[model samples]
Target: MKLLERILKYQIVTSLCVLTLGAVLFYFSVDYLIDREVNKELMRSKAKVSWQLRHINELPVYILQLGDSLQLDQVRYPGQMALVERKLFNEFENEYQPYRQLIFYERVEGAWYRVTISKLLAQRQQLLEAVVMTVTFIVALLLISLLLLNSWLSRRLWRPFYKTLRALDSYQVEKHEVLTFPKQHTVEFEQLNQSVTHFTDRLAATYQNLKEFTENASHEIQTPLAVILSKIEGLFQDESLKESQLVALSEISEAANRLAKLNQALLLLTKIENRQFLAGTEPISLVPIINRKLRDLEDLIEQRGITVKTAIEPTGPVMHPALAEVLVNNLLTNAIRYNVNGGTIDIALNAGKLVVRNTGAPIHIDPELMFERFRKEGTHSASLGLGLALAKTICQVNGQTLTYETDGPWHILTVTW
Candidate 1:
């Protein structure tokens, strides 16, 4: 989830909990306050009745009326004041109404008299309900407003972090381009940008040093390798060499050739890794490349008596031309080199994909390990085993996928983007 969404979720949940608890407390608080006001009114009525008893010297006629709101009764003993809630019947309304009742004793003319006062609470209850609803609505409106305002502010506050993320996504080490971070006011975001800039600087320095080293080492090794091959060729031409000596010389020659090939392959892989091909600047068609390579290998195919089938479609994909050649060459060579006598080589090309299938015995090694450098099956002593690995690296450099699978006696290699 996005950071803003998570923060808002937690805040909203906490606010809702507090509001629920506050609502319960609010209801009871209003109930108590309203009851206190009713009781005060009852005390005032009792005081007025006592004043009347002291002056008038007789029971008031108003107290004798049935259904009157107040009632007075003469008693022999003093009684304390008490308040209660009661359900009383109303003759006019013909229903039970809740009332707040107050009963107290007042001394008048040397005798104690009980006086009772009651007030209907049905109207007051309606008023309290309305007040509660209004308060709740106001609180809900405030909460909603708070959420919206907070969301907007959070998006604005986090804008710098998002900008930094986009920059990081687009950054590529091979490009060697200097990174420039936008100014950020927040301390943490500023620190993050600084750290990323420092890290990229270090990575670029390391890549430059590695590229230099690979090129220098490959060049230095090739010169001595050329000299060794020359001397080995001279030794092969000598007439006085014995049969046992000839075999050893041949083996030495073969080893030198293999070493030369390995050096070239490693250099090519390093170049691909360094993005030195510049294939991105131009578009290359695969149909012509495939046809030319096949033509070049026609003699080898005929020697093995292999049947070649092709279903080529016109495809124009932008990639390194030399790298593209290497990719196709490796795949075709692997297919031909491993095929049985009179085996079939099937090649297909379409938009954004290629598939090469060849008839061969099932590979003993796991198919998943086939792309690892120097991974070989059985006793293919002449094979260097870097072909598939180099091909996979080229595909990855061009933002493509390469996969291998075996079905029965047919080995399949697929390249797709």
Candidate 2:
């Protein structure tokens, strides 16, 4: 499901479940309350009937002397005849004691007369109607409140996420575009916005670098090819034997070699930039890699009469052996390439910091531009100029920082964790 739809679906289901539970509970509670009130009214009526039956003698005297002359027993009442057919004797019975129904049987001039005194019971149909009405009213009011509350809560909770979703829909990566989401009141949504912003920024940077790399590679390759073609065409124009022509051929060959090297370097940089070298993690030691790279460049260092020093600390372990090797190799190559013929190279490693210093001419290029692709400093312009750039990319992928500085005649490079 789409993210917003999923969120809304869960919210709605939860609200409905809660509302249903509340309604069931309310139904039982109201039923109990109404039942208690009806019972109380019935008890009050029974008490009145009991009081009149306790004074039966006075009741008969009052009933006879009332000027109306029609006695309660002499009249053939509908309810009275029904009670008589049931053989309802006029006597106080234990079964009626609880509800206070009293029946008095008396001999008045040798004729039997029965008097029934009982509280009127409510009809079963009336009780059923009352329960139905009360429950209907309560349920109606509860449902209305539940709907209103559900709407208000759902709108309030999902408002920010909806805005974020809309912003993401309109985002375009090709245009180097991003939509900034507002800070959400909820912690989870705020964290989501931060992660998305970081991802987009990195994507834009990688895309720009790829574009520049393609353009630079095309131009570098074309330049050497054009030179080789022109030299070949000039050689065909005249079958001449001259030292200058031989030198021109050698120069063309060297240019072709340089172009090939540049292509290989560019490919390697692309692979590293895309993080294709990330295999499974393995423990690696930095000292051995650094020492190995320095030894590989020993011949050049000795021929130039440069002094080399090392102060590597024994590290416990590290992940990504190949990455460490690449980083150390690139830094060492750059240091050797840019140093003076009879200068010094100093390498130090201690407390998670690696410092490489070389005695060289002061750099005239911008330090900020030094780590950029195709950027070259003075007198070392023949180099491919991507060694330090590759080193920087390696540091970034491995969660390290590569910084450069100039101290007098020494150029210092530092890598820190």
Candidate 3:
């Protein structure tokens, strides 16, 4: 959930709990006050009844019918005075209603009697209604205030934070730009802004230093490799050199050439990862590129006695044209390099995807492991093992997916956008 949503959820829950508790306490308090008033009225009625019983000769039964219930019962002895609350049946309403009773013993002309005075506790409903109204009013106010607070927070308080986030989202290390923000009133937001600015500043500096170092190292290493290869080539032309020495020199030349290629491949991989090549917005057609690569590699395919089949459409993914060429070349070469004699290579290109399935010796390990650079199937093989790694990197940087799967002798490499 969003941060504001989480906060709102907890606030509402706590407010409701508090409101419920307050309503409960308010209900009981109102009920208590109503009972107190009712009990007082019952006591007054008991006093009048006691006085009337003492003057029984002048008091008439009809005078006691003024809303209060009065009862008298002659007893052998006067018992203790008592007060109680109970629900009593009312004949007029044909239902039970709440009443408070005050009972006292009275002696009238030497005859003992018990007098009970009852009063209805009618304010209980009003207490309930009052509590309900108060709770509802509180709840309504809380809801309105919370909504207003949330709106104000989102628009005003969180504005600078979101702006800082947008700046960070589009940040690019290659641009070597340091991030700075306008002053913020909120301390936490200011701290966040400062931290982000510092982080981006450090990131840009580090990336620039690394880029320069990589360029310098690649240049420095390439000159020596070229010299070594050229010197070995010159030694090969010397007829005075022994056969064993020439063989050793040839091996050294091959190793040097492979090392140079590996270095270039690694540099290219690093550049792709560093976002040096950005893809175009529109997808470019792979038909022409695929046809061109096949034509160029026709001799290699024929030499290996490999049969090539293609089911292609004029469709491809959005990517840099140079990277597209490299991606296709690697997939095709990888298929050819690993194929058995007279093996079959199947190429299919559709609107959204490209599939290259080649018949090779069944690999015992997972096909996904081949994407790791320098991971080779054979220990003594001449292959540099960077081809699939480079292809995978290109697809990744260009927002495409490259997957490897195997079925018996057919190894499938798929790229999807």
The prediction achieving the highest lDDT against the true structure is: 1
Write candidate 1's Cα lDDT for 293-349 as tens digits: 999999999999999999989884568788888999999999999899899999999
- What's the CA RMSD for each of the models? 4.7, 16.7, 2.9
Residue 111 of model 3: what lDDT? 85
State the lDDT at 361 in candidate 3. 84
Model 2 residue runs over 4 Å out of place are: 1-241, 279-283, 316-319
Q: Model 3 — TM-score against the truth?
A: 0.89
**Clashes by residue pair, model 1:** none
* N/CA/C clash count, model 2: 3
Candidate 2 lDDT, tens digit per residue, 20-40?
Answer: 677667766666665565455
Better of 1 and 2 by lDDT: 1
Tell me how far the alpha carbon of residue 397 in candidate 1 is from the true structure, in angstroms, after superposition. Answer: 2.4
Give the C-alpha miss distance for residue 355 in model 1, angstroms: 1.4
- Indicate the worst ten consecutive residues by lDDT in candidate 1: 59-68
Using TM-score, rank the candidates from best to worst.
Answer: 3, 1, 2
TM-score of each: 0.79, 0.46, 0.89
